[model samples]
Target chain A: MKKSSKKTGIALLLILAGVGVLILKGVSDTGVYYRTVSEVLIDSSLLEERGVRISGEVEGGTITYDQQELKLIFVVRDLEEVEKTMKVVYIGIKPDAFDADV
Target chain B: MVTLGNLSQSAAFMCSLLAMVLLLTGLMRNDLRFIEAGRRALTGVAVFASMAAFSLARLFMTDNFQVEYVASYSDRALPIFYKATSFWAGQKGSLLFWAWVLSIHVAMVAFNTRKETTRKNTPYIYLVLAAIVSFFFLLLITVSSPFEPLAYVPKDGNGLNPMLQNPGMIFHPPTLFLGYIGFTIPFAYAIASLISGKVDPDWLKKTRRWNILSWIFLTIGIILGGQWAYVELGWGGFWAWDPVENASFIPWLISTAFIHTSIIQERRNIMKVWNMSLIVLTFLTCIFGTYLVRSGILQSVHDFGATGLGGYFLVFMIVTAVGSIILIAESYGDLRTAHSLESLVSRESTFLFNNVILLAIAFSTFFGTIFPLISEVITGNKLTVGEPFFNMVNTPLFLLLLAITGLCPLISWRKASINNLKQNFMYPFGLASAGGGVMFGFGIREFYPLMAFTLSLFVSATIVLEFIGGARARKKLTGEPILLAFPKVIWKLRRRYGGYIVHFGVVLVVVGITGSTAFKLEKETTLQRGEVMNIGDYTLQYKDFNSFQDRNRTVYAATIGVVKDGKAMGDMFTERRYYINAKQPTTEVSVRMSLKEDLYLTMPMIGKNDEITIKAAVNPLLVWGWIGGTFMVVGGIMAIIPSRRRRLAV
Candidate 1:
């Protein structure tokens, strides 16, 4: 019984190590920093050369899509500070919930 | 006169309480009369619950705005089908629907176990099931009652959510509920065994079919939900690692692990404690999944409005967890394995590895789903774990699982010799390598996709080899033709072969996912009339735009002409619809599906200058996922059906 459990324990430990390595690699490679528009505006350098997802409200009537270039340019207003706005340019299909005030 | 709906609700609530009391008394005093009375009360609960569900359906169909649930979820403009399905659209009605389904299972259990021999565990099963039903009844009758009448009737009612107006909604929720509620039966049986001190294989024999049924439903439910998200949400991707989706998936992962491990328990009378705890966890996850959807503690696209039921569900979860732990701890001495591992590389160890990987996946999913809450509570910052996290972490683990799926069948039970291993794996390994070479020659360059395809080929080869070897053996034994012997051998070993087919189906699904994710091409372009966008060998020309108003919504559709290899094929229309009553807009995607690939197009927005912004994707091998799901369900059913040999033995 002792020998068998020791074998099982070693197997489990090896598996756990493998999982740990995968998780570390996964988190480092693909993890995105999530921030609000105000946070990004406060420190724009925080997102330099890194992928970040910023949540904000789409300013009404300020959306334009250049069909020829497939470029979408819109103004996103900060929810907390409604007077501050940022011009965002995206080159993809709009999400279904993109129209909502985030 | 009291309305039949109200009366039925009250009666269902009362009967569930009475059944709980009687069953508890019967379990405590060892009395048969009280147990029988409890069984009758369970039947009463089922009847009243069904009546209550039907009454709600009738109210929705007849546009009875006097009821708050009907007023909130249905209107005269709603179709009759959605009106009927609206029986589970909201919290109140969904709770009642849950109770109704639970009562049906209880009544079936009561009726089927009427024999004296089966009565040993029936009272405890009754107690567990009744306790669950009583909780739902308590929630329904006090907090969220579908039968509650509105104080004032409005001229018209609010319609169903525009996103839920699709045909998928009609079947998705009920099938998912069927799966979610189905876990309760096996759980009740597990608890019954623990309480009765009869931790034998008999309980497993009685509950095996229920476990399979629940797993199948969950598999179907998750697939249907993915399909719905793919088509309705207008995102090119199907799975987004959403919280609500994870909530459903966690339970599925646990239950899947339980199902496999229980086989060991049934065969070797081992893993008894593990099986019981896994079932308990699965049941808890089911309730937790429901709680996550209804409580709105986590923000998700699929969540309903938040309610006060979070506290109730949390309390119930804690109590059940504590109680189950104590019970299992008390029964630890009786639940030891009759046999232990003989070798590390045997089928038993393989199963253990599989269970570990499955539980690890479940743990990661649970962690990722709650990371935002955890981060906020600790660091005061919300952290979101997106698809990349899930895909990155789970891909290698899934690949390992797929590899094991091919290897487990070839390995011997107690021990396997190196020669036996080589004899089984040599051919499949060679074929897989050759197949990988061919795929690489054909321009499959990505590491993950190549690995997924190669591993899938290996698994498929293993399945084919097994089938061929089995058939040849049967032919030699019976003097039958190989083709005839193949099916005969499969029928003779239905459970084993059916599992192989299910594994093959998983291979197909993995192939589909890897192909679609790695090789898919997406283009977002704006085109004027008579202008064309070229992608691969296909060209999409903007032809015309049209707008029309129906009773419910106004649709703006863009017609795009499809041209393949310089030849005009046809036109596909994609639309953006604005629902008038719901004051919401939804994208209606257009998909041209084929065996090789799907051409998916959606018009997310139109420019002010009359130019259309279109998103197009060519997703390869996507159809195989649905086909694989179908095969999995069919194989599950095949496994469920008892064989002639077993029948004769019985």
Candidate 2:
């Protein structure tokens, strides 16, 4: 019984370890750095080829949308440093909440 | 004059606090009088909480612009049902609603006239439940009261969010609250059993129906939320892996694990420690989920944004987490089981494995939900993990869970002999391979999806085979007809059969998700007059776009003449409504739903050249998700009904 218990413990450990590895790999594969537009502007290429989620205020009058092509081009200004900006070209239906003036 | 809402809210708070003290005193001093007083105090708490809730509802119904919450979420122009629905429209009102629900559940427990068990441990139940109730009321009476009066009355109010004006919104939050708050009952019972040192299966057996009931409510809540997102939110897909969705889903997953492991405890009298932690964790995660949704820390389109009460919730979460941990630690020695697993290949071990997978998935989702915060703390940079991370980690784990779901019931109780394994394995294996072969023949090339479909088939076959096998055995024994024997067998083991039905429902949902996600076809284009959009064997010709005023809003809508299978299907209308009292417009998507596929249409924009841009998707087998949810609810309800043996024994 004791030996069987040990095996059960080891089996459980192995499963946890396997799942731990999967979580690590998944995080590494899909983790995107959430950054401000200022940070992205300061060092876009310095970062690795991973995705970056930039949080900023949209610059008014710099937004353009192609209804047919579903292309959106807008300049996102930094919340902290308003002068620092990044032009974002996104391809999707514009969300209902997204607006130029925050 | 003080409002009745405020007065009763305070009275409820006082009664709950008094109940907790009296119950604790009774527990310490062995005084039935104090315990009985504590129970009565809890009944008072329930009464006052209900009165508080009703008062708030009355305030909304009467369009009482003097109350801040009622004024904020209701208006004169809103309909009567929505005015009542405004009772839980915001944080403050929902807190009262939640408190009222918890109070009712507590009162039911206290009012139960079970003599022996009642005398022994119900004081702890009263203490624990009243403690939670008092905490909610403390927040209500002090920080975020729904009855907080405005300095001056207004003639009219700022209306409810146009997005929340849907019928789905009316039912979704309250149903979810019922589900979330329902966990508190079993949680309190578990704590009572622990503190009273009666860590028998009595608590488990008693709370079994409560667990199943709460699970059904939660299942319905989640399904309604998904349906709301699909139809109302104009997001063609149901689940988006948003933090708000994940928050609710995480608890559901944990509670599901808890519910399953509890069956083990009820039978084998083991996994008691695990069950205690799971129920405690379930309660804590419910609180955390509430915090996630109401705290406005996470970004969701649901828009129950940032509030001052979030800090209090965080403190409450920490307190409960620490307190439950301490209680579990205190009872650890009592909770240890005599029976250890004799073999890893037993039904017992499948539940353990199932738990491992479930917790892994839960942990992964929780981690993904809070990853940005963790990243910001560790690396000084916020890192976001989206659907890809969740899908990558969870898909394989879910498939493993699906496989275990198929194999768990068929395995022997303790350990399976090779012959028993062979008997169970042969048919499911052959059927699954045949199903996989058919799918491959039908050009299912993707590895994960093919595997998913095959495993879905395998799981389904096992569930069906269990029924057939049981019915056949019963028929052979009694010489009864197959149809009569089939239902009788199922009725005899209703709990297991109900579980099997739920599993079958889950299999259907998996097939639906796999089909919809893997084989979904979508089209986006600008269509002028008579321009046809070809998407997934259906063509939609652009008819006309019109702008008009409805009763309360300006409706900009487009009509599309749909054609499917060379037959002229009726025109589909997708509209955007601009409400008078709201800055934003709501999207109403058009869907032609079927068992096989759904043809969905949404128009987000129209061009100046009289052109309309339509987004359309052929979502395959998506309806089964809702169908499966209904089956799960029915099976869950079926499982909870008292069996004849138990009824006769009682």
Candidate 3:
């Protein structure tokens, strides 16, 4: 083999090996899909406790807050081909401009 | 006031653009007359922009409600100080402010450096600055004009946002702007050098201290922003991976890398390409950061409005990016390192690694900050990439960087002997390992903190060893006490040793972050008129509440007795206030800060009949972060100051 090729051959091999190790170390979360509130409401039990952020436009006039418990309940609408709405319960006090149309 | 403001700012904008065209045409045609004309036109631009700023400030001070920007951001009720800060409180005025700064910096650069450099080089530098000023001035004229008037002038105007009515806000934007504007000087100089083919050490030496000044201001700006967030937002965390925060941070990172690696280029005639790339990247990132803040591609705490300037910023970015790419490609031959690597185990290699890691961190942060935009383009989904993602990715990277910092100082330049390496690092490594062991033994399960603390100990030990070694060497030669020898050694090598002290400050900051984030204790309490809550040997007794209305705002205050070790330490008051004209609520946090920890109390909200709810936390070593930040700023100043002995002797 040529000098540079011989020197780089081991380095390339070590890099590939390291990649293989990292591949094994990382779990495949690719199949675990992310769904919006309306999409998940169709099969809520399937995503009961899995990690996801159900994002949609916060529906106007559907936000209610309990100052005592600091719980906020709001309806989020998915404005896809078919308009669908889902209820979201948040525990913390809402930020300013939270009630505005998203 | 409004009409005059419009006239002056528009005049400035047109003048700057006219000057930029003149400079560009002059450089292209090699006409001295056009260059002189360009300089005079730019002077007009500077004068007009300053006059515009002065007009706006005058209107704000006098509470001139006829002006729309003044009406939107300032009021008769606001104090003189807050009224002054109204200059940057809105989009139109902030753009005007930005234009003002750019013009002044450009004017300063033109005056100072025009005579020193060649005529050809001087024109190019002037053109670069004028081009930048033209873009911003045009932005001011077209998209977000501060001089636009309201249809109907009301009796009262909306006041400043209560959250922004802090001491930090007054200084933060200017410092950050100084940093952002300061980068343009070196960038313009570099482009000027490339065009003139006077790409030598002369320009580099001329711009080095400017680089340091920009980096230092940017550093302090970021820390002040964090302090603002911690105090104003009451988020219980200092940095939240916010887009605006990331925008400032990226340039700071690149500037830091530039400052360090430029030393290599200066002394050893190496890393020339790297240093040049860093300067370009720093300036480009400054523009990119301005776009991120002003474009509204991402939502942030710092957004004024998304406005009509997104397309302008995007087009400017593309043009600048393409231009810089072409320039860098053409200048590749001039930037190749003049020397070869002598060894892998050397200061050179360490700097290479440091640059790589710093750039990697910068890339990761940039990716995270703009990930939402990219993801939306690719997948048609807007996903929030929050603190968790950044913390996860950056924690290990920072730990590795800390390891590099710990080891880099010990290694010699060009080449290092294995024996010398071991002799330098063995004790520090052993001490850090033992420290790690003790922390692990004490049930520290978090991998990140344990690693951070371990690496911090290693870095601290290395700094200590360097100081001791230098002091001892000085004492041996001069036959003086250690204290006397220390100052003598520092005087001789202020830049190098001062940098090491700054790195020591960074170590302390990292340690403080690790301690505060991992070991803080928090609790939420709802109390009646008279009640007490005990947490971690401190008792917080809820006392009476008070309500007061001022000209600026109405304050709903929470009185509490802070008792530690069965004795009353002091009484603290936290408030949730309503600024009347703005109609916004702001939280005022009360913090009892010390060397060890901070007793932080935030009044999240209040109810009718004086029922107060507070979120209180005992955050460990939170104060040290501020202390370390102060040290970083102080060390930077020390590096800039000429040595007292040298000055005296001279």
Per model, kept true contacts as a fraction are 0.44, 0.79, 0.03
Name the candidate that leads on lDDT. 2
DockQ of 1: 0.49
DockQ of the two-chain complex in candidate 3: 0.21
Task: Give TM per candidate.
Answer: 0.95, 0.97, 0.91
2 or 3, greater by lDDT: 2
Better of 1 and 3 by DockQ: 1
The positional error of residue B394 in candidate 1, measured at the CA in angstroms, is 0.6
Compose the digit string of candidate 2's lDDT tens values, residues B460-539: 88888899999999999999999999999998888989998899888888888888899999878878877898998898
Tens-digit per-residue lDDT, B525-611, candidate 1: 877777889876799999999999977789999999999899998999999998877655799999988889889999987777578
After TM-score superposition, what is the CA distance of residue B197 in candidate 3 from its true location, in Å? 2.1
Residue B290 lDDT in model 3? 82
- Give a tens-digit lDDT track for model 3, residues B125-216: 87777888888878887778887778889787888888889998799888998898899989988887777776675667778878888888
Sorted into a CAPRI-style docking class, model 2 comes out as medium
TM-score of chain A of each: 0.85, 0.91, 0.61
What are the per-model DockQ values? 0.49, 0.76, 0.21
Position A96, candidate 3: lDDT: 52
How many backbone collisions does model 1 have?
Answer: 0
